[model samples]
Target: MTTEIIDHEEVHAFTIRKEIEIAAPIEIAFEAILDELGADAQMPDGKSLSMKIEPWPGGRWFRDLGNNAGHLWGHVQVIKPPTLLEITGPMPMSYPAVNHVQYRLKANGNETFLTFAHRAMGLIQPEHRDGMPEGWTQWINQIRERAEQKARG
Candidate 1:
């Protein structure tokens, strides 16, 4: 339920990592995380975003934020299903550069630990770092909520 921005040695890249203890088992948590990759997943803000995912290495991943915003597009470079997913693409803000995102999951008894790391070299301008923390915080919270709900069921 907390988010912290870690300061790395690279000035051009920023990393945000969050961990949550969900009430669900590892399998349920894993499935919930994977479901979030779909276009119809419900966002934390109660908004439904359309997602298109090929779910394989070198496959494409996209989200429809609606309103003709085009698609937040990226390529899935790694997919270890129920464990890891790596994507390289532009942020929702349509930044002209591509960043890398890695999601790692581990099971601890009845709880599942999830880690998300985003690395954007030179794409996250100095001024943008301040806002990046909050943006990632929200995303992580959403993931935690969804996984917990699925586990409860």
Candidate 2:
């Protein structure tokens, strides 16, 4: 499994691409990625906050990262079960921003290839881009752990 960071000047966006072989079926991997609340909880620096997802197209995907410091409030833009899932939400920073996230899954024998991309729009510091890959790596690793555990049982 490898992780890569891509920076695009045209869109003024930075993307973190993580590829991990989870010891789980594709369907299970997809579910883990779509588990918004669970995923947030597993975030390396996340503090629970308040997360709720409707799990359908045009459904609400909202979270309050406690303390009013950062939050995610948006809707599920696209949902193709066990394959792709996308969500758009407000940025966690002070600047007016929007975040678009996508999860892609591919099945290989008994393993699953999962890739995630998070694009942040608006005023993003150039230096911040450099650290995004690490943050995403941690998140994906957590996802892999959870999915594999589910598969084992």
Candidate 3:
């Protein structure tokens, strides 16, 4: 059987949100995200891309090269450690795009509820646009695992 392909009507902005409840405290969960995004989100080569987050408002988040020569991933628009973090910029995208992502966490007794939103506006390619939903879910699960492990030890 042949597969049906969807046709694009126009270029549009896309927004995606994902959430997970980690069996760890808010601090642990938040740190897990920071660590994961900067290092643990794996690539095809069994290794993760390098990243550096400034961790404060007006700070920057980007690929970290040893000699400070790297691409700018985004800038920290808002930051409230263990609670919220927001970024805005071009991200890792090559196209002319605007990207924003937010990480929010809330403490419920011992466990922490983590949520994030990723929004991209530009001429998004079909391949890049289609894969995000599942990709982000996997990334979140990985972060959750790291947080839980940190909490345990």
Q: What C-alpha lDDT do the candidate models reach, one value each?
A: 0.73, 0.73, 0.85
TM-score of each: 0.76, 0.76, 0.86
Tens-digit per-residue lDDT, 24-106, candidate 1: 67777767666777754655576877887788898877775577655766888888867888988875545556688888888
- The count of residue-pair clashes in candidate 3 stands at 0
Which candidate number would show the highest lDDT if scored against the true structure? 3
Candidate 3 whole-model C-alpha lDDT, 0 to 1: 0.85
Residue pairs with backbone overlap in model 1: 39-50, 39-51
Q: What is the lDDT of residue 62 in candidate 1?
A: 78
Write candidate 3's Cα lDDT for 1-153 as tens digits. Answer: 899885654666999998889999999999998887676657545576777777888988888767858888899998888899899998777777888999899999889998889999887777777887877887788889999999999
lDDT score for residue 89 of model 2: 78
Q: For residues 11-123, what per-residue lDDT tens digits would candidate 2 score against the true structure?
A: 35666666778999999888777664443554455665456677899987666456764445677898888888888876344455678878888899889998888888766
Clashes of 1: 2
